[model samples]
Target: MMRQWGLAFSFLISAFSGLASVPPDAAAQDRPAVSQCQAIARTLPDVVYASFSASDVLPAQARAEAVRITYLGHSTFNIETAGGVSIVTDYNGWYRPAATPTVATMNKAHSTHYTLNPEPGIAHVLHGWGDGGGPARHGLVVGDAYVRNVTTDIRSGGGVMEPDGNSIFIFEIAGLCIGHLGHLHHELDEGHYAEIGRLDVLMVPVDGGLTMGAESMSRVVTRLRSSLILPMHRRGPPITAFLSMFDDSFDRSYATGPSVTVSLRSLPRKPLIHILQGV
Candidate 1:
């Protein structure tokens, strides 16, 4: 898939390099709620309707706790733990130098995965299959955090069409397991759910019908029964569709600032979905 970069993001790729890629597959799953969200994908426009400024973004040096998490745009995010463990997801192009994480993950299915090696430094870089050749690997560890990636096929273009492969990532840090769903083109079944296991926080792709769609994302959330939901990979019309459908009662609200900090001890006992401001 072609990846369109936000203006500020255009600089990092250098004078060459086109974009990243992901593996495709055959996928199809029915989600009643997602059907409702399809309306949003079809009707809404991109989020550029409202302009965002750097002042609105949190300062990079601002402390993020081992318990602190901040959504960078789309599937890209920075998670810093109190004990000095930091991880980022989809190190896609939509982030700045400051937002770059020490340990970042790359999904090979879409434009928003992986990255050119950072000038500062990167502790670990894990590749989600389709981009690499081999049996495919899942599970990683950086400091006190353990990470894993799972793959499933997403059928596109109508009846059982398969394109690129997709992956769902789970990062376990300080006992809390957080999952990030990337360019997922379909819903998960029982087996997929079992593989996903219990999630404390879920980073979802909410492009409505455009990218796996909202209904599908919701279904995963329901089964995973995660405590937090960080909506991503959404802009324009789809965001409206996703937000409209996410009207259930949970300890839900936007985060404190652009990023919300947390630690193992502060973990929630009950499920709560917090929409943190995306970078």
Candidate 2:
């Protein structure tokens, strides 16, 4: 009880002191001029995404204009930018792709989403949890991407809850704000939406019961209203249930291969649900 109050007090102080770090010019324009509340009030929603053909995988010539997202099974995705930076989401010890990543973001929902020991050669390993300290804080630039996180609580066990146990990692690359909801456990609050700002593409968990219920997850996805939605962290039954909630208005398709590259220009006018195989 005391710890919870202390954490609340800390948040209040941080809010009052204006302890926000300086964001990029794009972020500054979209986000509120304060910490915690990063999203700005917007009147219109814009669609932002791009894609490449299956044969275009890892072209020798670096395409600095588009972002490539390769599904490496489960909740892990290899996000490659035009400048040769690579990032792996929900990284565990298993399921490493051919190329090592420049950065790895992890969450503590389960062993499948995180690893105690990561590769030595990896440059950055961002943990979702605060290592029992506080919420994990990450705001760094690597090559062509800017990475940050917004923390949320998780169900520990026996109905107990642990605050700041998970993080929603946002990758700003190629003029797109790509968000990965790592082991999400609840519906987002107003503060979370504000901090998340506007997401162009979103990777969400649809396990129905593990991370959150399909209905609730669907509501959260609709609330974000990103251009593209990539489903992960579940098998067929849950994925099917999650998909049933969205009607024909959403563009639904499965990737031909294990990867799909997207940029701002290739985004659909309406929302899309992309199911990548091998997961």
lDDT of 2 by residue, 132-196 (tens): 58788888666657789989999998858899999999997765678999988889887677678
- Candidate 1 segments exceeding 4 Å error: 1-65, 97-100, 116-120, 130-135, 155-164, 238-240, 246-249
Clashes of each: 24, 5
Score every model by TM-score.
0.67, 0.78
RMSD of each: 17.4, 10.4
Superposed by TM-score, candidate 1 places the C-alpha of residue 251 at a distance from the truth, in angstroms, of 3.8
lDDT of 2 at 1: 47
lDDT for each residue of candidate 1 in 140-255, tens digit (9 for 90 to 100) = 44444556766766554454645335677777554456778877777776555555555667888776665665677776666666667777777555345665665554456666
